[model samples]
Target: MERQMEPWWKKSVVYQIYPRSFMDSNGDGIGDIQGIISKLDYLEKLGIDVIWLSPVYDSPNDDNGYDIRNYRTIMDEFGTMEDMEQLIEEAKNRGIRIVMDLVVNHSSDEHEWFVESRSSKNSKYRDYYIWRDGKDGQPPNNWGSVFSGSAWEKDELTNSYYLHLFSKKQPDLNWEHEPLRGDVYQLMTYWLEKGIGGFRMDVINFISKALDLPDGTIHPNNLYGDGSPYFINGPKIHQYLREMNEKVLSKYDVVTVGEMPGATTDDAQIYTNPYNKEVNMVFTFEHMDLDSGPGGKWNVQPLKLVDLKRNFEKWQLALHKVGWNSLYWNNHDQPRVVSRFGNDGEYRELSAKMLAICLHMLQGTPYIYQGEELGMTNVVFPLLEDYRDIETLNMYKEKMEQGISHEDIMSGIYAKGRDNARTPMQWTSEGGFTTGTPWIRMNPNTDEINVEQSINDSTSIFYTYQKLIQLRKQHDIITHGSFQLLFADHPSLFVYKRQSADEEWLVVTNFSDQREQLEWKDCDVTSKSREIIISNYDTLNTNENTVEIRPYEAFVVAFKKGIEN
Candidate 1:
């Protein structure tokens, strides 16, 4: 299990910033580039090496900047290109690298390329986006958009249908076209020239489309049927990616992490091979989308400890020796990890620390979402109108049109809505994310569990994360170490060990609300080599033979070649 340490990314901690709510600098009630500039010191103090900023490109805000109107221009709401340049310089000065979001799979309808494409069928730029004649005056096939229904939207002026996997305003680009591919490559090169560290590619795998464009099976709830399987990770995806890699990314020292929605480990290995030169890493949704059904429906399933462990183990084992995994629970798209994965009811502090223990111990780069360390919980929306996420709002409207009861829809929203995660970041006791009211309502619980409170509490989840990150950096074993899951079959316990030539560590976490125990018979430690390094329950007496883990308790035990186990 011993190994030699390597790259800093293998040990670095990445912090995700949803600029719209991370902070407000100009009192515009919205977070911006200057706002992010003000927070560099905070992130540097938190030991963040990478700051992953979500889309700040000019957009219509139809999908909150995902619909990019201009790849080169910064959104006016966020800041100007000059402001971004200053922010980047400032972050670099503070030793924090900036990773910008790359949303190239689609572009806004207003984008110059899309505008020209939709202008006329004979337009030279028409090939940039996917467009086809309607079948019998209906959408081209039954393909559906991720937002609600019909991924294919009709362009009345052109008498054609354009593909939009997400929202109608965000039309899918045609990667099959060489010119389009060249343009994207140039965009990457432009940013690299500007000194950006890397890219968090948005829906990167969706760039490929089904060669045959065959109709997939239909679900009762899927208005346009389940066609994502056919459209995602299409035939020539890797080919296009390799071309991009050669043209742009391979020329730089950038670390590219792609957002692959339905990518498997096999697919991951091909794209992220160190020698392959396609991508540096990828973010898989296998664990994040566990609560959703095959057709992207929220099924309201309580996360079982066994299921959670299984998902974690799958990725850990699959990518252990192949490509790297991006270990995280919260992002701009997902709810807070403390609330989603941990028990946030009464023991939120313990649960928050426990979640961090579970994730960071895995062999990968760890991403900390803004406000996540504060143990942020989901928003409590009294009405559907309270939500601001475009996806949530669209789904609500679509479901209502389908005759779904408002009460039932509200219940579904409570269980799984993107808005729950998009609420304003709680920075003060009064939840003053802005001088005026925030763009969206702050979670009511923010009044008590804000940044102001956690920054002052040594035992707060925020500080726990700070310590965890510091440990990852300080100890080579915690980073670039060989990972082996211990007690892998344990019902309620997730136990793993990280080992390097110089050190070894055992990480054990109880995912349930009840006390759990690990029998030495099922553990991987030897009689002469283990010592308790950290324990959440504070009952880590090295004299004990069997370890007792309280509800949501976690312990990290360090081991040397010779020590009493």
Candidate 2:
């Protein structure tokens, strides 16, 4: 089957909004859809093409909104469907598209499907979810869910074990069953009919499951999976996605960004290739999961600039050949990239600009998380109790059970907890989000790092992002150009170029704190002049042959067809 070329999401900038933390409308401490609606003007000015909102569906919130009990209804905490429609309408009015989170891998146990599936074996909905008979009165296998424990939970009512790749309250759906798969397609179609511009499919790759139900191996925490090989990227995933794409996604001018953990570029190519017509692009976890270990546990692994540069270059090259890439540094699931990857301690502005240049200059669709443009850092939670994210809480409890001391757990929490990203977005220093208490604690540094502080500052990271986005929109080469790495092996510098035969841009950045000289080697430019398009550092001097970049500095230079420096 030949897939028709259609709307390309690779050319847009997606801004992720964590609704519960964005802003408050009714003084309830929680941010609502109306609040998001009110902020459409701001997003418009920021030049965001799409707004990828986190899940706002009806849920038990055990795993936040990932534990959806009802796919059709908006959560009471978020707003009504009317409010959602209004938000979409308002965003559309301002030229921003809405992409809701699609959490189809699992559903809250309270969902009608799960409710009926657990009641009796002969029920019509029995096959809606994965249920297996207990083996010697135990769970079917030793596979552990992502949050921390057994992937299977025994149901007292039915005397059966059901699969849950996350919290037990959230049971994995049985995609192998035809009717269940049909229901997923129906749900997606329903959303598209309601005018959602796209979907951010959660754990999309895990929808496919391998045949063997065997327990791979056991770890110290009684965890298995380390066993994800059996479940991730299942056989029927492509079939299911193609059906949805053909029936729903392809019908409208819509975009789909799949969130598939533990996927390599080759794996991504199968799903995201436009020729396959499954998904437009996928958010690969390679860059985000750098802190996790092969031991199936979260550990503190600080990413290096050189390593980051290498990984970015590889993905850019690999995807350019087949499909497109969805570029992002911070999303709702990970901590702020400025604090994690860049030097957020002192050279915050310069580091933020450098990181933005590193991602924006790449040949991928860039995504910006709320508060990211302001160079936001992680919140300091003195105690675990202050955090609201369920994954962190589960890991904390598991470590405690394993006899890991409080200090060590706290250290790990400091390094890689989702709560670091879930803190309320700091809108202003005078509590711009709410006069009352926010749904979550604001990062202590919000007083200085808020958007209000960065908006007008010419040297601010926020302005840098604004310029980068404008540059991308203005230049066709930056959008569909070929990327070639220049100083890839250089330890302190990350330099690359994007060219489209007619135009060329040289992007250079100093990843370290100390100053470095960027010597453009082996390239002869015959152009009359090279113009400085954008720079995190000061202006370039005509006298110097070598470009001097300060600590964490970044810049883009536009070389005319025959320019010489």
Tens digit per residue, CA lDDT, model 2, 379-433: 6688777988888888889889889898988877776778777787778886588
Q: Which residue pairs come into collision in candidate 2?
A: 208-234, 209-234, 526-562, 527-562, 527-563, 527-564
Per-residue error for 451 in candidate 1, Å, reads 1.6
- TM-scores of the models, in the order given: 0.96, 0.96
- Model 1 TM-score? 0.96
Please state the error at residue 230 of candidate 2 in Å. 1.0
